[model samples]
Target: MTSRALDELPSRNPTGAFRATDRADPYWGGMFATGISDGWVSASQHRRATPEQKRWSGVPASFVTDPADALAQMRTNRHRPSILGALGAVASWRTITREQLAAITGSAVMARTYPKSLSAPFSAGLLAHGHVSAGMNRLAPARDRMSMWAVGDQIDAYARYRKSLTFAEHVAVTGGQGWDAEHRFDRHNVLTTELALRVAEYCDVATVLGEKQMALPALLAAAGIEAAQADLGRKPDAGIVRRDGLVIAVETTASVGRGFRGKVAKWAQILQRHPTYELPLVVLVVDASTPSQATSAAAKNTTTAEIQAAIREAVRDYPGTALNRTADRIGMVPWPTWFPAPHEATAGFLDLTASFLARGHGRDEGWRQMRLLDPGEMPYREGTTAAGETIATNARLLAATPHWLRTGTVPRTDQYLVDQASASDIEVLSSPRVPDRMTGPGFTQSVAGRKWRHMIRLDRTHRESAA
Candidate 1:
């Protein structure tokens, strides 16, 4: 592979870190500003203040003050706990020094934790009302390390919280759950909207490269106006109209999985009817990681290379034959494939979104569909036959391993059965005579069913039997 220096490639701003200048009030902000003070006071009082708190409330009063001196004094004091407690008491007093307050606020803003804290009240309010949805509330930890939040789990929590609170109470707490929910949805929408705008913004460039025709500069001018409008929270009026007379529909999503698969299939059908215009459909996958990497030149180049490769492959292997045909009909040619060195694929979605938005279609709905794509049917329940067989084979191999022999291992106990059984009844067998865990057929078969339950039972049972 020919390696290029990081500085060699043309640098484009991959991070859509452009702050939207439109100053319309954010729903969450309004919700928080109105509700946080009261909620904070209530939550604070509920946790009764102690004598130590009283003492800590007023001493070394400012956060900006040199705490080093106070810290040293505490350390030197024979009664360190008493001194420290007194300092804390002084600090906790509601009359925080202006300097201390400023320091605390500045730190909170930098950490992004301040927003989270402020949102708690609003979140409480939403829980009071019943407007939150189940899926939104079920945010769980992400299976992939790349994601920050278990979006499903967070959604679930938010939903549960909303269910318990009234709208007014929610507003009192933070703006309520509805506001928070809207914020989440709106962020996703804005991202998708930006993607469409990006596509529209770059239409002329694509037209030049793909069609080998000079598109009117006016198209560029229109795209710029739309981009500005999108930044202002105004949805731009744009649609995909191909030369072949087909009006391409746009969908925005935070996730792209099974839900989108159906949408894509439907779009394919629609494109079939408009044989004149090749359906020009675009999918903009918005990634939040681009800005993080874009700050460093080396990281940026590596990211760019990976993005280019992925996009090339995606376009080349685009599943829709109709879409490919449309690209050909429009005299569009794919851009030259020049991969940047030290490729990283995480930013592919961002790069693609920027490229498309720069072309001209800036206004569209953003949709988030979360699911993993499996080439074959998922091996859950009815689909488990083959997977079960594989597990069984592996389990037998594991049974013959020395670990199983030494441990006296048993395999394949169902979860429901284990759940019904007493903890003492379960046993784990670890015998030298048994094969390695992976080699045993029973071990593999157990894994096919309730693997954890089976293991736990086997372990407990073995220890009991040995005793």
Candidate 2:
């Protein structure tokens, strides 16, 4: 970030390294530097190049090795208004001159996301991240946002994502076929690797995120590490091989749903049996939007604390109420992205990781088993908000509402919402309709399965004609 440091970075990528970074990218601001010997290189925002950036940013890439230095750099560089504003503009799918961001400061999150962009051509992926209802009031942390941008790798993923729009109706995406059908987190490879960099800071462990794809066991053996399971299958977010030769599996999730509870319980049983098999899970539920009347000062603490309580309530029944003894191995270290102190709050990731490593190895039989990540140490990557991002989604029909008076049968869904231009209001009515769409509220029970996009009448009128 200083003059001499900039002088040390290569001005040109002589390797023609196939590295990629563009300020125009929407998610994962830029590619994580993999196998790069140097640190990060800033992206150019202007259509034209600046003489200063040309000399400084040499497409810098790095697999973060040192936690303290990497996090501090992220915290310090977060103040660089030029990049911060550029990312906001990119997410909103707008273009602004670097000069505009130069004066930006204070709560750095943009007010609106893809909803306003929902109609925009650029939001084809629908990048509905974090809070869905936050139209013009969405807030993002600078450290988390900027750090994520530094790991941008969205181009190839965009190509495949564009094709998902053409998916046919009535398609059945059983198994994992439907999960990767759309572009969820295109930069997840870089995102996970950045997380490992932070983990490497506290303990001696090799991460699976940044390693080049090779035979799994071969890679682990080469690194002198071992996995508790034969397949360290891409299930866990990140894991490390500690110096003491123990494998600590790390998982972070935005959803505290039943699925998450089951995952925690699986690891809980694993740790309970193995005892020293420490798994630190970081659960960050993005706080709700500020109250319409709440001032910025009040919204900061209140919203985050409320979210924290919601997490506690969700975790209350983990593994079940009867299994309190089994649940003690699983703990929570809450990292609230509390208000103006976003940067400091995120640094908690490092604090939590250090605490776990220092006290683990079958030690604190009862201390908060899974230490919630400190937000500060979270600089290696962004704290996830939502588990899913709609790069491509099953469509919702825009057809006019059927006249129940004439049709005599309502569609077969549990409920349906109709908005009529002639009516003064719109109403979401509960109905006997069935399986309207694959990606909406009724997905779980819709036996028609994923990619099905129509609701039909439950009446025998259509059934008799089949004969």
Candidate 3:
């Protein structure tokens, strides 16, 4: 086979199915096709000790050894985006099943030719399959079917690809405890990663920082402050940063059970000191109700009033000013549990976020009332019917428009808004030249506006203090 053809192998294979080119070939023993490694040692098992070219028998001579290099080489390949999505998901979720990874990345076929594959030796060992120990359960099946996983050390090359060693550094900072929970599946972290992935479809994946990536101590060190100044309390589940210096901290919750107050208390701590971290807005993403939360009328399944009351109770002993600041700077939005988000769900959250942003900027009347409509193109909005039940899932953001104010309406698909903003000189908010549009003194004198202004003023104070 030609060298170029070997490299294109991954793109040719179908998602979730890896196979050899010719069944008659001696090396083509239907190994990968049946999900058996055939006792082949993975590159990760080698720990970079052996020469990959020699070790990876039957692998393409041109297949990259570094995961970053592997992804870089696949720039023109159809699966590059899916590969990136996989890497990003791993960075947050840490330990995910192969099925989940396939769903998140939208591809399972990483290897094309017999023994030559992007999922193994060619990619600097981006992922590893390991024992899913069901401790002391002798009755457990002989094999763990969901074996594929991405560990912090295994995927470091992707961090190198992003040219941000900080991503890898924090993984070490936590002693990689996040991945240590091998036996139990952390639905919360997995769900959070899913949310981040969904949000990333709209913005730069690099800009969507997961909580594990935003370790407080590491952040303080990067900002030139002593790590000791900050306690490793609760941090945002994810952070979305705009080029215009707007940072939205996201906190997600799936349960409102007995421990709900404790979670709120932790959140209050972060919100109370948000200015120190330069986090101006904290968005609470309430996932669909669990059985317990749904049945409990008092818990109220993630309503704004319920969360606000919890926040008030958490900081009741604090000064009135602090209480007000905490309440004003925080906003609660329902995370669309509906299959594809309802048009109103998307519009409501965006308008709320925009309204918060429009507080200080006078010319942002357009932004305050900004809205996003589905245009009937969203595949998941209408949902699917199966087993005589209609199911609505969650909404995923498609394109990011940092300059939505100037653009009028933002499109919810890929490349349209991002490319339009970059290719044209349409006074984009992403550029520093549009500072006045981002910062000024003119908003409605409504009580809500005044409250937002108050929150911004305090945010400014905290940022200045940190500086």
Candidate 4:
């Protein structure tokens, strides 16, 4: 208790209350975190505003008074009923319709239209009437706009209707070809046009029978027109054949390679399974080519005639069963029989094939044909002529070739070596070419002249390698 002891005793701590510290309870801490003025007066004022005033006023009066405090209160009561809610309640009736809401929201608006004299239960009818009457005044272009909107709706309905058809029904409507559906060709303008016409007919029938029609006839007609444009020249060759509650159409195209042959083989197998249905596949080879001296010049040195003869001979040896039974059942028609002259043999063949597949016959009936072939100049060069110009010549050669050969045919002839006439000039033939005494030429030249020369050389080389 001496003077020394008093000096040593710690002075009363005065800064303890001002020391930085964290609160254990966040709720109470948050309450203390805000400024007293912002926490109390500003927050309370915002909570007191009328809903109508808040709704009508762009910037709320509460926020205008104390922005910071009002903001805090607004954040806290974001989900709660406020002046905006009250205003909405007062204007609820006005916003009931989609158009009314759109007007307020400044959104895209949709409305109905009808004849000027027509009346209906909804305000939509009144709007329609007003639109029609206001040609030069307030509602000018209203009917045109309405028609456009109606077209959009019609397209949507047609899509929905197409989607709603049963698989069998879809096949029947698309002329029974699976490729049409697989490739979406059935949705072409031609097909759509046909469907639209059918839909229009249905509407007519509905009207006659006093039935309610959901889609407009005008819309269907438009779709039909589009379909017609898209399916130009292309047509279904096979007719619809119904069996076991299923409808299928025969489809055919000139055999190109193993891929097409495989398709044919598969069809043949399927026909075996459903013999009662008859073969629905057909093959047509059309010649669409112009005889050109340039083409003759290009092919002059080539053994095109010999090759064609060999191919014809090979096809003649193929089993008759290889031909699609459906072709025979449906009646095979030559390309020239169905198409007019001046047609490329190849194009005419393909067209006839497609037509046969679409109509199941060679004769071009009234049914429209849709052309899916690319509309450009042909690229193949037969002789000196462009392939397009010589399509008829090449097509005839192709048609004479057997399906197996066409599908399996691979060019074994080395074009580069063939381009050079003299065997001595060909470097690739040095080791493989063997001289022939009878031909009075080198082995390579003599061997090259033989039938299936490339295949023979290839086989010989393989044999030598094995030994």
Candidate 5:
């Protein structure tokens, strides 16, 4: 890559897929693809993620589906990558150079690559530092000292991700109002977040209608979080609502230090004044190793529980509009999962739900007659069939209604259910969900603002002092 061209890439990749940061980006994918990638987190770590990625990508094969090779070729047994290893891994694929890897990835050892093709032994592509720092030693001094921490490389993984498309175009499909809409998701993090929610197959009528955010009444009912939409003075990052219960406000932050703490403080304040009883606020701290957050101690040094405890303490002292002990009602959680195991989530986890609009039967009466199938609390489980069967069967049985299963009769195929689940930005709605606009405090606006915000219903076991 040209010096200028090489300078433009993002340093890290979206790590949501592996609960990692820039280190796990696609540019680094070549590292994994080259059979020397870190295999600390096995495919089984993301049990639901693999199937979901394959399903939404609409391709049976992708990283998630076929990770055996990468796993087998693991170069290191370290839980996380060493700095030196990362630099080398990226450079091994020409993403960075060996010298650069040595400086940052924690290696002092270095080598020079001579063009065997041309028989030249000179360093050809050594990059001059792009932005010279104020204290940088302008004079090339001979030093053999390595710092405990090194500044991370600024290779934009997103830019590289665009160049390194792996899945088929159909894999990008999402089942929003605009069923077959064009490319709405630009980032893998955004796309995967939506797909994960949808594939868990939680909502029957999950949709993105107009300028509204994503909303899934079915998931709400399943998770038991009251679902509603609201128009705050300013639009929130994301949130899920309840008509008679709590309004869970979810905010995502890729920043740490003041920015991260500020978001938590603000959301905690919102939880205090929120018009619901079970108003638990969740702040999703994105992958911590991004350029903005990687340097912050809160993101790097503090444990997730420690941060949560800090947020809880901070919220405790903040004055509330209606309730006391409001601190207990607010929560600050790590990205990938706000709470503990079995319920890990990204900030998008509750912005709204990603769901497929099941176009029933055919154009004749099919369009007019369609039912939204909910994936229930257990997303991987089979949702109700068109025949009203709760256990998911083959697509052929989609039209099977409640009577068909026990009646031992082949249900009429007229009621076909086609899955159009993928991510999209179009503000459209499935014909059925379009209805009389909901009215009330939060219900005054569209429940979904047509973005991939996540919504989570705090189940009974999870609801704590955060009410």
Candidate 6:
């Protein structure tokens, strides 16, 4: 961005707001001109002039439409790309919570600065509507995270710039939820979206399908499953589609909660129908320190054992070796945090995941090793090794582990693989657990469900005593 001359300033509106006119200022004037025309600035906001509110009148140092250009201008203006990425990401997701967007982009400042002091960047080819303040005519919920909705009547030309499908056919195939308004922003959806973004960042080569996309008719058809099965609501949290037509289904779960056995059976039904799809199910199990019935180390010795135990006694009376082998596809690891903290703790895990999915040899090696170890153990513990060196060496280590585990010796070139692999036991150790509190609407609903079940049990017991 270059300095603007005295003649280039946007003309002021009748109400003292600045209105952008037809000019070649791609960074500022041209991009924001539509916002003023569309009545983004409300009349009530102009009633008073606070020192903070006056900053909106100041000239922009620079603005850039292209991310590359924004990066180039980072030294002069730090907020350009962050704002650009935030705008595009929010548009792509349709309605993302502030926390979700922040976690996805790893930008705290971006999380805090939208729809309030962000009118300038908010207008970059998108309409800004506050979901929190849309009705009730009051301030947003005091404790709840405020969400912004950027999809309005206007066509979003910036949709192509967002890291999502822009074509009508592609959107239809991969799920058109991105273009629609998201009614519920629950923990499951938030974590799923975060995982998708993280996977997209590290696994740039493969196409990441979000949870909604996983249930799409086109995707299910491609996976050799019927649309009717999807209607029954059996689907993975996300998926990775490769060039070779193999789809690695990714499922994230906090536990083998109630009905997990039936859930696994439903998954098996889907998996049995589609051989091309593999369920590399990942679970967030209780931290060993936390007092729970599922904490035995023996049960968690391998991915299959852990998953089998998670699905638990429900599968015992149910027949078949088929359900038993289904555990082969599931992996369990201690939660890095009590809640999902993918941005802070899961980079290396995702990096190793990318490496495993990048090539045929690596994916094959990962599957072979999954029988013995959890997938989370692949990345060398952070700070013990260089940034990506551990990830690169982990691939070699995966191949060499079998040889060394059997013969107790590896070649000289693969010596480091043994050293790192031997010391990675600490990788599975759990993080400190905080007392679980119901903070968000999602958790509140979960608590209500628990209460409802307790009431039913009490009612049943009272009836039995009377009988």
**Model 3 lDDT per residue over 1-467, tens place:** 01222223332223222222211111111112222222233454444445664453333334436655555554433343344344444545554444445434334442112223335323555544332232222233434222334443443444444332122222222323242222123334444554444343332222355565455565445446554433565456666543332345666554445476666665556556544234333445444333334446655544534554555565553212432344434444434322122111232432223222232235312212222111121111212233001000001111111111111222122123334435323322222210010111110111001111111122444445534
Give the per-residue lDDT of model 6 (tens digit) for 77-154: 234334433443443444444544544334444345242324433333243434233222123343332443343332
| lDDT accuracy of residue 140 in candidate 4 | 35
**Per-model tally of clashing residue pairs:** 127, 26, 6, 52, 48, 0
Q: lDDT tens digits, residues 193-257, model 2?
A: 33333233232222222121222343344345465574364245433432223233444432245
Clashing residue pairs in candidate 3 are 16-108, 16-109, 338-392, 338-393, 339-392, 339-393
What stretches of model 1 exceed 4 Å from their correct place?
A: 1-19, 22-280, 285-292, 319-467
lDDT of 5 at 230: 36
RMSD of 4: 38.0
Evaluated against the true structure, the overall lDDT of model 4 is 0.22
Better-scoring candidate (lDDT), 2 or 4 = 2
Question: What lDDT tens digits, residue by residue, belong to model 5 across residues 1-467?
Answer: 01121113221211112112211222212111121222112223333456665343221233233233322222222211221132222221112222333322222232122111101001111111111111222122313111111112222321222222111110111111111111111122221232222212222221111111223343233345554543232223333222211233333333346555665666555545442323323222333223223245565445544455446445555645433334334434333232111223332333332211112213211112111111231121222223232212211121101111112222222111111322121222122121111121111112211222333223443333223
User: After aligning candidate 6 to the native by TM-score, how far in Å is the CA of 337 from where it should be?
Assistant: 8.6
**What tens digits encode model 4's per-residue C-alpha lDDT throughout 131-218?**
1111122233433421100011111222333343322222212212211111111112112121111111211110000001111121
lDDT of candidate 1 over 1-467, digit per residue (tens): 23343223332212212211111112211211211121112112222446575333221112112223323332231322221111111111111111121121222121121222222322222111111111222232222111111011122434443343222222222311122222233233222233322232222111101000112222223224222231232111123332222222334332334544444343333323233222122222222222334456676555444443333333333322532332211111111111222221122222232232111114322211211111121011222334323322322222111111112223333333444454433333321111111212122222222212322334655656656
Indicate the worst ten consecutive residues by lDDT in candidate 4. Answer: 205-214
lDDT agreement with native, every candidate: 0.25, 0.27, 0.35, 0.22, 0.26, 0.33
Off by over 4 Å in 3: 1-88, 95-186, 203-206, 227-230, 257-260, 274-285, 291-308, 318-324, 337-345, 351-467
Candidate 2 wrong stretches, greater than 4 Å: 1-183, 186-193, 198-234, 240-242, 277-329, 334-349, 353-467
- The positional error of residue 165 in candidate 5, measured at the CA in angstroms, is 32
| CA deviation > 4 Å runs, candidate 4 | 1-237, 240-255, 277-334, 342-467
Lowest summed lDDT window (length 10), candidate 5: 118-127
